[model samples]
Structures are given as C-alpha cells and as structure tokens.
Target: MKTLNDLLQLGDPRLYEVCEPVQENELPMVKEWVADLHNVMEEIRAKYKFGRGIAAPQLGIMKRLIYLNLNTPSGSVPYIIINPVFENLSEELFELWDDCMSFPNLLVKVKRHQSLTIKYLDENWQPKVWKVEGAISELLQHEFDHLEGILCTMRAIDNQSFKWRPTPDSN
Candidate 1:
C-alpha cells in the first residue's frame, strides 16, 4: 500500500476518467484503497494544517471514493465514503472560492449549494447517510465533481475571475 506521500496529485489523466462501479468481488480492493487513502490523508494533514478531505482521483485512482477529516476541537478522524450519492441539494446556491490539488495553487469561485444530504457506504460496507452544510458541503461537492470528470476550473465564474493562493506552508 502506498503512503500518502506516494499518492499522485491531480492533472494526471487518470483523475479525469469515470470510475467503474464497485462490485461484490472487488470489496477487498476497495478496502485496501480506503486504507491507503486514509494513510494519504494522514500524511497530508501532518504536513499541512487544513487538509480536511481528499478524493480518489486526487490519489490517481479513477474511483468514486473520498476521505474527509473535518478539523474539530475534539480531534478529527477520517471518513471514507464510497460511491457516494448526494440528495436534497438546494437550488439556492452560494459561490465559494475553491482550489484543487490537481490544479494546485489556483483558486476559483464556483457555485455550490449551501447544504446537501449524502448517501454512501462506510468502510464496513454498511449504508450510511449524512447531512452536511457550510464549507464541508462545498468540499464534498468539489470532490464529487472529480468523479464525473469535472473540475472547478470549468465552472469558474469567468476567466481571470479567480485568484491563486499557495498552500499553507509554501514559501
């Protein structure tokens, strides 16, 4: 299994392809991917202060999987969501400035819902549901887009409209 340090970043064409649906026979591989993803997130969090989430494509895997570790005072733990589905998205949208590991350092303002209800399988393969709002919701939408071969850059309000910011530790 590759550590987070070894995970590939975005911009690789592999990140742009649609992932195959998870099958009963592939459960073991999916579990392994989840483990590796958690390791990747851990590595990222150790180096960066605010890396709360990551998607499969960000790791060079064209699969509908994501791992998020929302930072909270109590301490954060990773949540692995496989083949996630979003529901109850509001038509009422908000424009949040965002960036991607794939497009590194570029920030774009993209439209997103303020809240969402999501359904996905947990690590144990049991059905789980979550309702998220605020920045977390935006993050999920951003990661989910990767599964569909979409990038925030494509939805930029306009060319030259967004700004680029370096990662937290960049000098």
Candidate 2:
C-alpha cells in the first residue's frame, strides 16, 4: 500500500501540473488512490499533529482527487472528493495561515472566500455539492488549488506573508 513516506516537497515540477479529471469507469483505480490518501493523511495528521485534508498531487499522483478525514464528536468521517470545483464563492474573504502536505514546514498567510459551494463526484460516482466555511473551507480551497497547479505560496498576500513554521527543536 502506498504511504506518506514519499510526499513531494516544493520545487518539484510535477506539483505544478494540473491533474486530469477522474472518470466513472476509473473508480476501481481511483479507489486505491483514495485508500492511499486516507492512510497517508491519517498518518501525517498523527505524526505532524496537523493536516485535515490532502490532494493527490501531494503524493505524486496528478489526479483531481482529495481525501478529507474529519474528526467530529461522533467519530472520524472520511471523504473522497473527485473532480471538485467551486460553484460559487462569497464576495467576502478571510485571511488565515495555510499549509500543504507538499510544503509541510511553511505557512502562507492567504486570503480565501468566506463561504463557498462546490460540486464534485463522490467515490460512488454520485454527484454532490457542499457548502463550506471556516477552516474546512480554506482546507478545501487549498487542496483544490493543487488540482490546478496553484499552491498556497502562490496566493500569499505578499512576500511578507510567507512565513515558515518554526521547527520544534528551534525553540
């Protein structure tokens, strides 16, 4: 099974390439990618104590897919979003520190739409739409950008907004 041990970092040209849309007939292969994403995201969250979602490009797979393992009061719920695209975004926006699996050690202060609705296909190839806000909204945006070869660093408000997360041992 593919794991998180080989996540691509910044400067990798592959990370800048847009992903191809997944098709219904590709579910068999896509399922495996979802599993890999789930395992990798879970492991990264446990190890780094960060990351709520991840995109396929981060794992060197240039596909329009993302996996989100959300922890709620009930239990953890995993999502496999395929070919996700924002249908609408609120005019209002908010700024927050954004991070990515591809660039784990850096935090870019970026602006995102305050509210957004997205259209996507689920693992079953069923169409779905969702409203998102707060952190998850930003998370989805960040991951979706990966599908377009856009990184959080590219959205930095300014050069000053790009700040690296301090290493644990540096303190």
Evaluated with lDDT, which candidate comes out highest?
Answer: 2
Worst 10 residues of 2 by lDDT: 162-171
Q: Write the per-residue lDDT of candidate 1 for residues 1-171, one digit (tens) a residue.
A: 767556655556776677655655667787788777777777765655446677887777777888787768899767888889999997878987887755555689888999999999876788999999888899999889888878788788878768967667679
lDDT of 2 by residue, 7-114 (tens): 888999988999999877889998889888888887777776787888999888888999988889999888899999896798989999887877777899999998
In model 2, the runs with Cα more than 4 Å from the true position are: 167-171
- Name the weakest run of 10 consecutive residues (lDDT summed) in model 1: 4-13
lDDT of each: 0.77, 0.87
Provide the TM-score for each candidate, comma-separated.
0.85, 0.94
**Residue 128, candidate 2: alpha-carbon lDDT:** 96
